[model samples]
Every structure is written in C-alpha cells, then in structure tokens.
Target chain A: MTGGRLAVRKTYKLFIGGAFPRSESGRTLELEGYNVARASRKDAREAVVAARKAFGGWSAATAYNRGQVLYRLAETMETRAGAFAAACTGRREVARAIDRVVWYAGWADKLAQVLGSANPVAGPYFNFTIPEPTGVVAIIAPTEPALDGLVARLAPAVVGGNAVIILASDDHPLAAIELAEAVATSDVPGGVVNVLTGLRSELAPVLAAHMDVNAIDVTGADGDVAALEVLAAENVKRVVRAREDRSPWEIASFMELKTVWHPIGR
Target chain B: MTDLQKRGDRSPVPTDWTYAPAPESTDIVRLQERYGLYVGGEWLETKDQFTTIAPRDESPLAEVGQASEADVQNAVAAAREAFKSWSKLPATERAKYLFRIARILAERSREFAVLESLNGGKPIKESRDVDLPLAAAHFFYYAGWADKLEYAYPNRSPKPLGVAGQIIPWNFPLLMLAWKIAPALACGNTVVLKPAETTPLTALLFADVCRQAEVPPGVVNIVTGDGSTGAHLVRSEGIGKVAFTGSTEVGKAIQRELAGRDISLTLELGGKAANIVFEDCALDQAVEGIVNGIYFNQGHVCCAGSRLLVQESIHDQLVRKLKRRMSTLRVGDPLDKNTDVGAINSKAQLDRITELVQAGTDEGAELYQPPCRLPEKGWWFAPTVFTNVAQSHRIAQEEIFGPVLSVLTFRTPDEAVEKANNTMYGLSAGIWTEKGSRILWMADRLRAGVVWGNTFNRFDPASPFGGYKESGFGREGGRHGLEAYLRFE
Candidate 1:
C-alpha cells in the first residue's frame, strides 16, 4: 500500500493433525493488524488427542528416521528465515532456532549411548538400560525470544522419540505458524508437532490437566508455573519448569529408562 | 474335588522314594523374646510389639518392635541429621565404611542365612546360597562405587540427595535392605529403612552388623512395622528420596501420595512375568528353569515368571515334563536343606493363592498340583501349574505371588510378544530358546523390565532392576540405580 501496490495478506491458523485448521470455537484475536486464531480449550484438547494418537508411530520411528525429519524441518525453516526474522524482529533468532533443530538432529541416535548403557550386574545376567520416549509432552513456549525459545522446547522433546503439543507465543505466533507450514511440508509426521497459537493463560491449564499427556514443559508459563505443576500431579505427568540449561539431559528428562535383565547361560 | 482327582492331565505319580529330610538345624539361629527398633545405631523402646511368625509352622520366631508414625519420624530425623556429616565425609572414607559393612556381612553369613530362612520361610538352601550371598554381594558392589561416582557418570558432577526413606518387602528382606541401604550410604545419603513385618528379623540382625561395622550413628536405622508405618515414612516431611519394593497396589498409593513433591522415588512393584518356552529350546533345561521360575521363593518373586507361554509345538511335551518335575519338588519344611519349595510366605498370601487356584478351576482350566504332601502346621501350597488357561483368566492376568503358573500357547513370535506384554505389570520375563537371534528379537519386543533368556529369577547388584509402566518406575541396582538416590546438576 505504501508503494501503491496491492499487498497479499495471510490468515494465521492452528496446526493440528498435519493440517492448518481454524479454531473449532471460530474465535480470532485482532493483533498487529492480523487475525490470529484464538485457540480454544477444545482446540487444545483436539490437538492433544491427535498427539496421543500419533505418539506410538512417532516414538516408534527409528532415531535416524526422526533425525532426518527434523533435519528436513530445519531446511524448510532456513528457506523462510527472512519471514521468521520479520515475525520475531531478528534474523539471528531464526538462525539460532534452525541451528538448534540441527543440533538436536545429531543427538537423536547418540542420546541412548550418552544416557543409557549396559550394566555388568555381577551375575549370569545380560542387562541394559535403554531410554525410551516418555509419551506425549505438552510444551508451553516462553514468550520473549519467541522463535529460538519455541525451537528450544520442541527439539529436545521429539529427538528422544517423544511427541509434543506446543502452544505458540500469543503475540509473536506468526513465526510458529510459518514454521508449522514448513512442518507440513517437512517429513515430520503428522501430529508429531502440533502447534496452537493462543493465550498461554487460557490453554496451558487444560493441557496440564490432560491425563493422556505424559509431561508438561512449563517454561512459557512464567505466571502459572506453580498451578501447572500442581495440576500435573493429576496423572503424575513429569513436569519441567523453566530450564536454564539445554542439553541431552533435557531430552533425557522426557525419556523413561527401561532396564532389561535377561539371564545368559547354557 | 481333590486337586489330583480333578486335573485334565493325569500326571504320573512319582513312584520313586522321596529324599530323606535334610533340614538345616535352627540351633544356630538364636532368637530373643523381644527385639526393639534399631534407631540411631541402637535398639530403642517401642510403644507396641508384634510377633514375627515363621511361615513354615506359624510359630512365633521373635517379637519385633512395632514402629509407629512417631518412630518413623524419629528414624527420618536421625537419617536427616546424619546426612550433613555423612555427605561431607571424604569419598575414600565413605568407601571404607561400605567395605567394612561388606566384610561384616561375610563374617556373619551363617547367622544371617539361618535367621533369614527362619524369619522369611525361604528354604535354608536359598537363604545361604542366594539370599545372604546376594545381599553381601550387593553391599560389596555398592561399596566399590562409593569413591567412583565421578567416574561412573563422567563429566557430570554427582551429588547425593539427603535422607532416603527405604521400604523393603518380605520376600528378600535383608537382600532388599542391602539393595537400598548400600546404594544410599555409598552415595552419601543416610537412610530410614522399614523392613516388612513378616521378615523384620534379618534387618534387625543387619542393624547389629551395621553397629559392629562402626557406621556413624543415625547413618542407618531399621524400623519394623506394618503398612501404616510405611505410609508415614512415604508421607514424612524432609525425605530426599523414597525407594520401595512391594506390591503394585501399595506402590500406586505411594505414587499418588508423593505426586508433585520434589522428592525422588524408585518403586519395585508387582509383576506377571511371562516365561516363553520356544519349540527350539533345550527341553530338559527349559523344564528345570520353568519349575525354578515359579517354585523358587514359593513364587513370591516380583519378577517371577507367573505365566508360562509354551510354544504350541512343544506344549504337550513341556507340560508333561513340567508336571513330572514339579511332582519331584519337595514342598515341606523351609528349614529343610532338600526342600525345593518352601512356605507360602503368610496366611493372607496363602489364601490369595488358594482363591486364585480355585478361580482357575472354576474358570474350567486344568489344575495340576503335585501329589507331594504339604506340612499340616504351616501355610503351604504345593507346586501348582494350570494348563489350558486362557488369556482372560485372573491367574493369567494377576500377580498370584505364589507357586501358580498359567500355561498359554502362541503360534508365532509376534503372538508370543503380544501375549507377553498383555499385562499391566512389566517387571520381568523369561525366554527359553536355542536361537540367539530369536532371543534378541523377542527381548526387544517384550515390555517387561528384566528379561531372562534360558534362565529365570536371577538378580545381581550390578544389574539395574525395575518395571516398565505399572511395574513402577526408577531402577534399583547398578549405575542407573544411583540416579534414584542422587540429584544431578
């Protein structure tokens, strides 16, 4: 309009079950001259159902296969780095986010070695501790460093075979939906990465209480950390509050250790 | 109808004469009329007392101090107070203490072995050969890790959590005690241990060993009581961690009780392990393993192979051999050296086994209990196996925690795995096969925590053991076991 040309505009929607869908509640919030999907509790629940349904296949996917899909997502995100930069106010944030996914991609296969090992359990038994994904994880992305923070929460979880349902930043959610657009094209399986753009205050509590959900990463809920933690106890979902460090342990935090002791002898 | 008269398979009676009774003399196991709680490295007065009866004859072996909530609080406080100095001690010094405990356990082996059999109703042979030896081995293994935590999880700075509240089961009292206390002490955490009411004697005896080893006062305390005392300790404030080995029912209540708390928990709960016998397995060895799997510990093992999933091809042959082998199993005095099966742990447990066995018959499954005579004085269950058992049978699904086995058949590897993982409890499994590839393939698919190939009911200190899903979480033993007692930065 500034240059006397017709500018194309996009409508932001929630990512559920591999497709961009309008909120089931048909609610939208007017922010920065854009119609952002004001995701409803029902929408969050649907995403979770879709996520729980997808957990088995995604978690059962080979580590190499998961790493490849994540790498493809990074490639897709890199192509739209400029759009993400504009949404988050910096290109560096988008780059860090891309690098973070790549970093996590390298960790998919190596994590078991770093986190699990065979035990010489002083008998004629062959024992091993294998780290398996801790089912569906509900992630609340922190508001500020929007793009980087979102990637930071998403990568570590799925890298260890866990499926995630991430609630995008309320104001700066355009980048996440754009990332979701790439997720649609990327080999990341449907429902593996479900993103909803909504008020963290409105969505997080319901997700926290969802019994089917295995863990709640509440780094985003700065205001409702205590409430989320208490709500998580309903099903004893593993709760991770604002984490300062980002390592394989973060991946491990969402992984359950399964030790097998088999007797070995004639 | 009588068990023998009602069976589908007419198991050939063992015409051979039974072995002469080889009872281990209880003379060495001297008992006191009353034993108090071992709190702060010394025996203390208790408000109440309960008699711990031997299951072999329902005879009161000793009266143990019944620890109340107040007693549990005192133990936790003692453990918490000891943590400050204990955690500050040099690693080498801590290792020395563990070494001392291990040495003392070895010296008092016979005393512990005899008392273990008398108190827990396990066969004397098992107490001496399996229980006491493994208990001492647990101490020895954890003792080596005292100075080596840094190397164990390289690059990670390992630090001990404060006081650990440990609750052990009746099945392997002192051994479970060693599994809990050794790891906690080695990690620099003090402990408040509650031994099961049925088998509190060996733990009390272990306390004497701890005192003799000169372990710091309040570093290790043994409080004996029933479920309520354990509930108090589980809910008690200021406990850094809780490690429990018991039934799945109690484990869940504890999980719900500790929900949202920062305290760490490691639960070794119930299991309905599937012992899959393949067509290619060494038939004779597999039969011996199968009998040992269920008959050992009177089938009181959490990791006991309660379900026998024999391959359809070898189903008849295996069942005939199993029935014959089970018949030869001498179920009599727990103190008897020749006994293959012992007492059924407690009256309540015996009733449970009886009720389930009745259900198996009521459900139209063929019940084939051996013709061996059980002692009239004690809670006894003959070595029993139920054939033609469906997947829906309660005996097939539930943890009988007794010498009851449900036989099911599978046509393929996938079917075997599907049936094996059908239970809510995934503590352990047994796979008998000659094919190495099949063993690995089946091991990968089975959901159980521990998988035994060609053998069953084997445990070691270095092995990390716990269940998947409701078999409970967190591991006990090995380097992974250390995670339960430590807080990593």
Candidate 2:
C-alpha cells in the first residue's frame, strides 16, 4: 500500500446553503492545474435565495448571540489555521484574517452602542435610532490579500446582522475555498454566509440586478463598480462601493438606521 | 371611543355621531398676488406663475411663482454663494440661526398651522398638534446638534457638503421642509429647497421665518414648483447634495438621474407598511393604531401602515373593531378642528385612490366605507378598508396614498413576516404583540426602516427616519440625518 503512492487532490466546490455543491452547469476552470467549480448566474441566484432565507433568522439573533457565533467562527478558523496558511500567500495573512474575524466578533455587541442613539425630540415620546441589517447583502470580495480581504468584507456585514452571498476572488480562489470550509464548521447558521467562486463578470451583474437583494458590496468589483452601482439603482439597492476604511461606518453603510417612536405613558 | 362616548349615547351607529363644527379660522393667514421665488434673502423676480388652490375648498390661496429655469439657476447660485460664509461660521453661530427659526415658528405657530391645513388639506388638529409642533421640534433638535457634530459621530470630524438641493412633498409640507432644511443648515450647508406645487405656502412662509430670524442672505432659499421645476433644481449646477421626500416613482427616477454623479441623495419616499396584529395584542389599542395608521393624513403618509396583517385567530374580531374605530373618524373640512380625517390633497391623488379602490373591488375584495359625508366640492375619499384582501391585490401592492387599508390574515409568525415584507416598499411597519420576545423577533424580521412595536405613524424630529428598499434611502432626523449633508474625511 505504501508503494502504491496513491494521489489525493482537493476539489474546490462552491458553498451554498451550507452545502458544498458543484456548479449547476457542471462548469469547471483549471488554475495552476487545480480543478475549481465555475460559479454561474444560476449559482449566484441560488446563493441569494439561501441568503434571503437565512436573513430572518440570522438577523433576528440577539447581538450577544451573534457575537458569540462570529467568535466561534474565529475559533474554527484557528483550528484550521494550517490549512488556511498553506492555501494563502503567507501564514501572516491567515493569522491576520483570524484576528480580523475576532475584531468583528467583538464589534457585534458593541457597534450598536457606537452607531445607535437615543434622540431627544421635543415631545412625550421615546425616540431611538437603531442600526438594523439591510438584508441579503451580495458582496464582491477583493483580489489582493485574498484571505484577509475576503474576511474584511465578510465580517462587518455579518457582524451587523446581514446574511451575505459573496463572490470569492476570481484571481486567488483557493484561500476563499479554504475559508468556506472553516465557515461550515463554525456556529454560523446554514445559508447565513454563502461563498461562490467563479467568473465575477457573469455573477456580479445578476447579483446587482437581483430584486431580492437589498444591497450590493462592490468593494472588489475591480473596474465594474460604476456599472454595478447603476444596475443596483434600478431596484434602489444600497450600493457600498470600494473604499479603504473598514471602520464601524462600513457596517453602518450596510445597516438601515431605524428610528422608532413610542408614546411615553403607562 | 372616548370622543364619541363623551358626546352621549355611545351607540356604534355612524349616523348618530355628529361632530360640532369647530372650523379653524383662516383669517389670520394673509396672501400675496404672486409670491416669487425666495432667493438670497429676498423675493427674486420671476415671469412664470401658478395659483395655489386650497384642496379643502378649491379656493385660490395665493398666486405662487412657477420657477423658471433662470429662477432655478439663480437659486442654486445663491445657495452656492452663501455656502462660503455658512460653512465658515462657527457651529455655535449656526446653532443660533436654527434656534431663532424654531422660536419664530413657535411664536407664530397658529398662523403656520392654519396655513398648513388650508394648503395641505390635513385636519386642523393634526396640523396644529402634529405637523407644526414636529416642524418646530426638527429645527430645535437640529439646533442642538449644530454645535455638537463632533460628539454625534465619534472619532471623526464632519465637514459640511456645500449647497444642498432639497425637494419636499405635499403631505406635511412644512414638516417635510423642516426635515430637509433643518439638518442641512445644522451641518452648515446652505440649501435651495423646492416645496411641492400643491402646497408651497408654508415653505414660502418659512422663507419669511428666515427673514424674521435675520438668517444671512442666501443661506436659505425656497423655490416653488411642480415636478419639472424640481427636476431643474436637482440637475442644477453647484448642487453637491440632493434631498427629496415624495413618491417612490419620483425617487427612483431621481436615483437614475443622479447615478454616477458626485452628488449625494437622501430619498424619503412611498411605503405599503404592514400593521401586524398578533393574537396577544391589546385589541382595543390595536384598533386605534390601525385607524391612525391608515387614516392619518387621509393616508397620505409615506410610512402609513396601509396593509393590515392580522393573525388568523384574531382576524374577525380585529376587522370588526377596526371598522368600528374607523367609523368614528370625522372626515370633512381641513380647517375644522374636530375633523379626524381630511380631504385628499389633489384631484389627481383622489382619482388615483378611487381607481385603486375600484381595483380592489374588481379583484374580489370586500370594501367598507363609513357613512360619513365629505365636503361637497373638494377632492375627498372616504375612510375605506378592504377585507378578504389577497396579498397580490392591487390595493395591497400599490401605495394608494389615500385613506385605504387592505386586511389580510396570516396564520404563523413566518407567514406574517413574509406577507409584511412582500411589498417592494419597506418604509415602515407596525407590530402589535404583548409578548416581549415576539416583538423583538418580529421587529427583526420586518424589513421596514421604522418598526413601531405597538404604536403606528409616530414621528419625532430627533428620531432618524427613512426607508429600507424601494421605499428609498438615506435618513433624515438624527445624527444619521446629518451624514446626508456632510462629507467625512
């Protein structure tokens, strides 16, 4: 058996509805002698459905519960640190990606306090501005620092209570697939975070034009952000274009500021 | 319940309840021949003109200037010119101007309230109690924020975006103007605001408020017009930001027009808000919320709860109670202090509501109207409710923008969320449940920007307001509101 020298290769399948499934069209692309499922508009469509289905449950989770779930994601990612390190450009990037997840996990419970307000209106009323998740955010993940960039875009949206359907980096796909593996093992609910890897061009437009999608994060659309923004405007989807700072405001950009007024009385 | 019962034989008969004629006097509001555009702290000359007629009685209130292209250009230029001094002023000084405006509005509150009811066709009680007070509160709220922008959004310095172009709707005309102008002024941005053609008087009166407060020249300008004039101002030169509160159709059009432009836009548009009544709700209060949700402003509110989703267990009881509560609502003259529901804002809006109500009837839904008499001449729609309304019915799907509620039943919490968020518009929603956990769950699931736990149609100045989806974007009212008019470094 030792002399047989059998070969075992990894199959990079798209993650949807918490299941690793091959492309519906059975399309494949070979990058550096690796077989990767080529995600189609249909796959993006399926991810959006899954994300939308998961949105109600995931967004309804208490902030503390969500924070714990996201922190669990960081723990799972740490256990698979070696795998992520092998797939990514460096061990430092994977380590930083884990740290970034921890960063967002901490923000899950605290960001609301930072972003929300108890407004003082001149009336017999209790007024509040609470940041709520804009549902089913479709994100186009960044190319450079594949593992870290992908984590940066994914964390804030989910931390703020949105379900995400992200198009993984077209140039560097292996790290994203590894990250998806860690996500499946984490406490994140099925369909809460769906990762599809393939042609960004074919998928981004469909996601942008998707009526079910409430927002589009074109932070990694490369040159297609302007076009995607216009398409998003067709359905009035909130468009968060590529920007550097991953501040709390980045999460606020994907969140709806809901101001509630209740009459002050017994 | 209290209003009618206090009068005597608290029988639920609609014919028995006759409200005393408590008409608010309109003698206080003085009108001009042709009110030209307010630009650079003065009335600018304009050739084009149109008459602003009262929707309650169809009498000409004033001959308002129809802003020409040149007039739009002048307004933008004036705002741009003032932006220099406005942005350079100290935050405390800026706060003073807003405080002055708020105080002036309060001192002359009754006059403004009367003008608002006459021009917008809202009940005098609402104009006085809701619109006028909220308008003053908006300016007052923003005035405090003017000097404290640094504390509002921690860890950042907020810089004012120059020369905002604002356009408001006919519903709560003065209130919408306050929502638009107050925040922009607080953030140190000079504004060129356009009031809706149907109701420009209160805003033109606001221009007078600016003068009385001695706000610097060109700091605030009011350009009156229909949609075309609004279009010109939107595309006008030197407009760095645009804020509009109107119908979603116009909001999307404006979004398309402003796409890829550097200008930032905040749209407060239409809604088909779902008023969800779960099994455990306080049924009587739920009935009151249902009536207030749809019948308020004659259902002209963008955040109005027009879709009623009652739990199947409470369906019959809730509908019966809602119908009874609606029957008590007095609908007639806008100036009448006793009126609960008033005339439709325009003939076009009234016709639209009529056509949609007809579609509901055609779609096999049961229609109910209280046997109340509307004023003889003006545009009016009775407080209407459709029972057995399918989620796909036209009345359920469209924003009729009049006093109409579509009643549908849901058996489960999941189904209720599904039906509530079924509309393309997600402006506001109401959840009526006594359970603490369920309210949190429902508020989480409901897609609306503003979710009322047990109340409906409640608004406050400090409370940021807007929508989630096709109901439009950006917020106006709190710290989030200032971001619409400020550029962050």
lDDT of 2: 0.88
Tell me the tens digit of each residue's lDDT in model 1 across A1-266. 86999889899999998989999999998876789999999999999989988887887788899889889989999998988888886988888899999999999889889888888866676778788887789999878788888888888998888778999888778878888888898898899889999788999999988877877897777674667766765555667654345688778778777666655666
Clashing pairs in 2: none
Q: Which tens-of-lDDT digit does each residue in B133-201 have in candidate 1?
A: 888888888889989999876766889989999999999988999999999999999999999979999
Give candidate 1's whole-model lDDT.
0.85
Worst 10 residues of 2 chain B by lDDT: B1-10
The reply for model 2, stretches above 4 Å from the true place, is A1-8, A76-89, A120-127, A242-244, A261-266, B1-20, B278-282, B312-318, B411-415, B433-438
Tens digit of lDDT per residue, candidate 2, span B41-148?
989867878999999889888889989888999989998999999999999999999999999999999999999999889999999999988899899999999999
Q: After TM-score superposition, what is the CA distance of residue B384 in candidate 2 from its true location, in Å?
A: 1.3
Model 2, span A1-266: residue lDDT tens = 35788767789999999999999989988864688889988999999999989987898789999999999999999999898987777889888999988888988888779988887766675677788898999989989788898898999999999999989888788888888899899999999999998889888989989999988887788765667777887778887864445688888888988776555656
